[model samples]
Target: MNRPRLAVGATLACAGLLAVGCSSPSQQAAPAEQAATVNVALSDAGCSPTPATVPSGPVTFAVTNSGSAAVTEAELQAAGKILGEKENITQGLNGTFALRLEPGTYSVYCPGGQKDTWTFTVTGTGPAAPTAAPDTNVADATTKYHDYVVSEVNLLQPATKTFTDAVRAGDMAKAEAAFGAAREHYESIEPVAESFGDLDPDIDARADDVDDPAKWTGFHRIEKALWQDRSLAGMAPIADKLDADIATLKANVATATYQPAQLANGASDLLTEVSTSKVTGEEDRYSHTDLWDFAANIAGARTAFELLMPALQAKDADLAQQTEARFVDVTQQLARFKQGDGYVDYSTVGDADRRTLANSVNALAEPLSQVAGKVV
Candidate 1:
């Protein structure tokens, strides 16, 4: 039920929109470009407003879930990565996210429809060269965020090894114990993982995400064998691949570029990640260690928000204060579920508690959503 549903290798030319074309994002729209708005309707059948052509430059996709239980998200993809997207749009919700797109073709993915994908060609030349350089603070935010991602990767690479080594050694208790320890690092920097083409899925994709079950690999795959199957015999290959993939992510993240606004949007994405799947306890169905991921996702968003604080505060102090307050609200609420250094099993969370957690996420998401616009 939960996976990186947006990670079908579906991408965004400019995504992470909640403005209701229900887009999701790995990055934000270009700052100087004037945004062109487009509305796409999502239904059980498919995306309704499939535009054949869109003019070049920035676009805001307002994706509305016109009544689709299964179809809850949408994405815009280009060049093998998601630029932006808005996801978890259930039956009636609508939201927007923006992107600065260069001329070319982009894919619109509304997973769960009969015909789940659409293509739109971006016409005309792209944005004119910027007259001024970006704000210095914004530039610093990007650089710092990049470094944060690298540091998280440094932690993840070794932690994954500890987990994988336990898996291969047939030590079920050790493997299970190391699972949540390793995943929190990846969870904290998921948007960085998503920015790479198939890296996110290769490392984190669940069984539901793949067309063929045999193809499923990565953390969850090993997780299922450890918790559900109660064996480690076949996991050596999966463990090796998982470690190799994290190594690849560690290598790629050092060179990746970022926009300051993406930090805000990435925070939004992290919050959305919590609200969408993790909140439902579907993220770690087998292990029941979802709260670990829940914490990590929020922590990642919090990191981005902190990194963007300088720029965000410079632009809108009131918004910054409100955003910070909301972060506290959510953090306090989340702390209720914590036990020791980790959180309680997701299975123990009652419906009322889940609602409280989801509510906190929504409260923070509202303000976090606005951060990019003001700061960028």
Candidate 2:
């Protein structure tokens, strides 16, 4: 019998190989029969066993990237929804993922600009085996959250570059305008930003974070230079540091792992930032761009909530619906303050409007806090 090479530390070997052909008699009787397995080879052309139709039941895909590309990922998708996937499958190496798929049509995606897709079918099954156990749900949510972080971080790099370029060029007017846009991208994924030690502070530290006035740096430090001093003469190095910090964050987010509870708490923490600092007009004190950061923080927190929404809905639909409704309410209230792509200056808002915005955010935060308990 032929045996496909197994990935490192693979728990289960390729299924359906006859014990008589490949294993000794003693080895054959040692372990119970395992689920069926399929060997999938990914290369420049695409996935082999193209249209890998298989039976519906417990199945393991033994995937190998035989292509020249440095990295690739294999995903099992059905109806445009990902059922299972493994990322960072390096060339010439193998990786495996198991799934108990229901009878249906599925596609294998080997994404690397190859545009490779292998459509297959899962036949014969009473019902698709439910893979939505607590642990699985948490794992799926974590993967999605990491993906979101990567996307936001990718966007941050260019946006920060634009802001920093303007600052370094001594274009204070353009730099001030670019500030809110760059900050928004960072604010949206601030939770993941906390992972890289000192990077977040290096990019966003406020004046009080440093004891020495000369030591203060990052966005707030630059903010003072633009608004208070009304100049960008000494901001070139600061802008360069901010750009470097964002580059560091982008690298770190690619491998970061998140726990479901942390995601739940992260959403709440973003709101806490809004209520304590953003709402009070403290975060963008000089630029008066607090509203931009406030909205960005909402976008980020909402992303965390949306990522876990599937698990939450499965665990408790009523609570999920309630939480979703609250989010919509807050969004609508925030929209009232929108002016073009940004919001009205923080100082322009009257006390009544501030109180109303505070109440809306608080209301959403209350139900949002229960997400971890419901999902986990």
Candidate 3:
């Protein structure tokens, strides 16, 4: 069942504009003030220089990945949202990013399975700058993302009907084929699906989420019956439940609220899902249709990024261009694995190709994380 866990902690850290220390050549010279710099080292154990305290002003983070073979990402977060991040910090590389901070508590997330938490405090007496006025750009992006969710959910309705009908007819071969088609539409709108109370778990819950085996219902449960058990005797009810839940999602998404930051966070979360479970074939263990889900997740995330592009470009053109380029690269890489209108089975995808796909996803996730900061 491709139940996606939002990778909210992992954030983007990258090169951005340096703070101006002096006036331009055509203007009078001003006093030079060096921005504060923090050195952060990430390893398998934990981040070094833990619990750092800094002044409230422009600060630069010099991050080094001293971890093992597993790639790591570093991020600065506040109020459950990423403020800044640097991603794809390979075993031995270093990266840097600059951000202006206000007085507050923040955490540095080093996502590579490291459990140790690193937090910091920003303190200063300097008068805070006036907050920027709310812009319509973010509102527009949110509306677009909401519309996308509704469209995907609507697509799911007809697809689910076909899938359920195949199951009811006891045509196992046709049902199995219809399963992937129906799942693609669901996966594309998973974030929105999850917003509906209990609907997501009802339609896509894995066995782990259920306390009792008999209580488990929805796609994976039906999948087990169709593939592992090789029986359709008890699957019609599960199909009906899935159909109802999807209908519920269709109605909920019509009034769902979206934030500009969610688009960026959701994009990163999708890639994290691909790297964590989808690439490993753990998501669709029974049917081996992980590729379909993986592609749909990527499509969903890419759509969010595309909708936020205008606002992101206005704030940071360089970052926006970098993100778009990486998205194209990843999309092209995935296209290589396509077979006709669908993709090859996850079981048949080679290890090298999987690694390539993972790398491309990580590359895209890096810049995508910055979109929130730029747009919001």
- Scored by TM-score, the top model is 1
For all the candidates, what are their Cα RMSDs to the real structure? Answer: 4.8, 17.6, 8.9
Model 1 agreement with the true structure over 44-92: per-residue lDDT tens digits: 8877554657776556678898678988877776555666677778888
Q: Give the alpha carbon lDDT tens digit for every residue of 1-376 in model 3.
A: 1232223332212211111111111221111324567887877866654339887655667778875544366666554444455555678877665555545566776654455457767776542433444455655776788788878888989998999999888999999989999989988766555534356668888777566788788888888888789999978888888888777777766765554655676676677667766888877889988898899989998898888787777678899899999989988988887988788888898899889988988788778765654543
Least lDDT summed over 10 consecutive residues: which range in candidate 1?
Answer: 17-26
Ordered by lDDT, highest first, the candidates read: 1, 3, 2
Model 1 has an lDDT value of: 0.77
TM-scores of all candidate predictions against the true structure? 0.85, 0.64, 0.67
Give me the overall lDDT of model 2. 0.68
Segments in model 3 whose C-alpha atoms lie over 4 Å from true places: 1-134
User: Lowest summed-lDDT stretch of 10 residues in model 3?
Assistant: 15-24
Q: Which stretches of candidate 2 lie over 4 Å from their true place?
A: 1-136
**Local error of candidate 1 at residue 242 (angstroms):** 0.7
In candidate 1, stretches whose alpha carbon ends up further than 4 angstroms from where it belongs are: 1-33, 48-57, 122-126, 129-133
Better of 1 and 2 by TM-score: 1
Clash statistics: count for each candidate: 32, 0, 4
